[model samples]
Target: MSVDVEGKSLVDLLDMLEPAPVPEPISMVPQTWGWSVLALILAGLIILGVYAFLRHRQFNAYRREALIELAASDNNAAKVAEILRRTALVAYPRRKVAALHGKEWTNFLNQTSDNVTFTDGAGRQLVEAPYRDVKADPDLEILARNWIKSHKRERTA
Candidate 1:
């Protein structure tokens, strides 16, 4: 079945031809765009998480200090009242908080929350009690702490 090729066999002729060149090995190093984009997104998320953590700590710093002072007061009504006043000052304007007295001060405190009413409730003692040399009510301390923890900054008229 072989054709004559200058008296050489077809197999010999075929063998004399060069074999197809093997494709050059593909480059081993991967393309950088995909890896670079993935790394950038990962870095952004890490930075966002760190920022959120730091902002949260900063926001709670006031509450932590208020609790520490409340604990140190040790049932002293005058001291507790002073601490409350100082805490309020930080969150409210000086004029709005400075001149408040007795029922007015308690009313202001009550306005900030629905959970604790300072005027006609357990917190009534915060008014007259501070003026006298009386031991602070533990319940009032708890109420004040709760209010400080959850009170919104919006003032109620």
Candidate 2:
């Protein structure tokens, strides 16, 4: 069991042993780009959503101002009528709203906003309320504000 190896050279001993196998170099991370592409797409969608929200707020900026003015005004009837007229003028042509009188004006208001009937409901007060000493319907104020906030503009040629 005790063999002598004093005469053997280091190269002969190394040549006698088997060589260690060389491993192929490998990358730890996968090569797929789907995750980065998905992240970029998600970021783009969020940016587009925020931009759409800001644009919508800008488009309805006038409604917010009118509501605030309506809330702060002392003369409810005159202010309500004025706000409606001004809003109509902005939405429609001047000729359409300029000469409307009494019931016709109320009817126009109702047509513009299908949610409330201005002619038959509390909005009828707007006809004579501005000219004479008349008490404005408290409900009309709420209805008008809601209409102004939610009314969709009609396209006129």
Candidate 3:
């Protein structure tokens, strides 16, 4: 069943209708310039933070290597002393560290580290270990590891 348009032609029917209202298209980009600038700054800061973290890890790679060598020394005093000296050379100037020996070396270790163990404590064994038949002292190993972990780096002018 249909209602017939008695007087209207197809062109007349088309002319009688109006166009539907169209909505504005939504934008995916941020609308405000401030928001865009803030987003760029935040992204740049994140990138900078990641770069700094990676550089810090790379700078401290020597510490990781020294710790590994310390672990592998098997509590041998001479080996522990050598490892500590090599680690010191990496952290300090070659002229200052390479020439250090005996009590002078122990004093230098004490000066660089937080604890005084290197001067009078278990670390004294480092001075004698290389020169004489010294027993492997676990405390000396611990002291050497502590020094390696805690020693301050020399400041460059």
Candidate 4:
């Protein structure tokens, strides 16, 4: 069975039909201002954290150098003493550290560190080891390494 289109042509039928709706293109940009603001804040925080980490590493570079020198000294007491002196010079004022020697130097070492004692402990080697013919004590190297790693910075005021 078929219905007859007596008066209409194919072109006329096509033109009479409604056009299909076109959907709006989805936006790539964020819909809200708050989302954009949050993204910027997150980027800024990431940059700040990276900067702080790099500065911390740079500030502690002296400690890393001193430790390397200590390892290369091979338990030579004179070399160890020189390394400790040089490290102290970098950590403290030149005037305060440059003139210290013998017992004063040992006392300064003890004062700066909370855990290690240079006066009566293995650190005493620093005082007399360089001048005397005494054999190098392994403990002296360990003590120096500990002091170099953990010694507190001097207060500026």
Please list the C-alpha lDDT of all candidates, in the order they appear: 0.82, 0.79, 0.85, 0.88
Off by over 4 Å in 4: 1-29, 133-135, 155-157
Would you list the rank order by TM-score, best first? 3, 4, 2, 1
Task: Report the lDDT tens digits of candidate 4 across residue range 64-109.
Answer: 9999999998788888998999899988999999988889999999
Superposed model 2: Cα runs more than 4 Å off? 1-31, 155-157
**Candidate 3 per-residue lDDT over residues 23-140, each given as its tens digit:** 9999989998999999999999999999999987987789889899889987888888889889999899999999999999998988898774677667778888887666677888
Candidate 2: worst 10 consecutive residues by lDDT?
128-137
In model 1, which regions exceed 4 Å deviation?
1-32, 154-157
Relative to the true structure, candidate 1 reaches a TM of 0.70
Order of candidate numbers by lDDT, starting with the best? 4, 3, 1, 2
State each model's C-alpha RMSD to the native: 8.8, 8.6, 6.7, 6.4
Q: How well does model 3 score by local distance difference test? A: 0.85
The number of clashing residue pairs in each candidate reads 0, 0, 0, 0
lDDT score, candidate 3, position 125: 85
Model 2, TM vs. native: 0.71
Write candidate 2's Cα lDDT for 1-157 as tens digits: 5655688999887777768998988976546898778878999999999999998788778888888888876547777888877877776789888999898988787777768778776877788766865556788788778778767776755
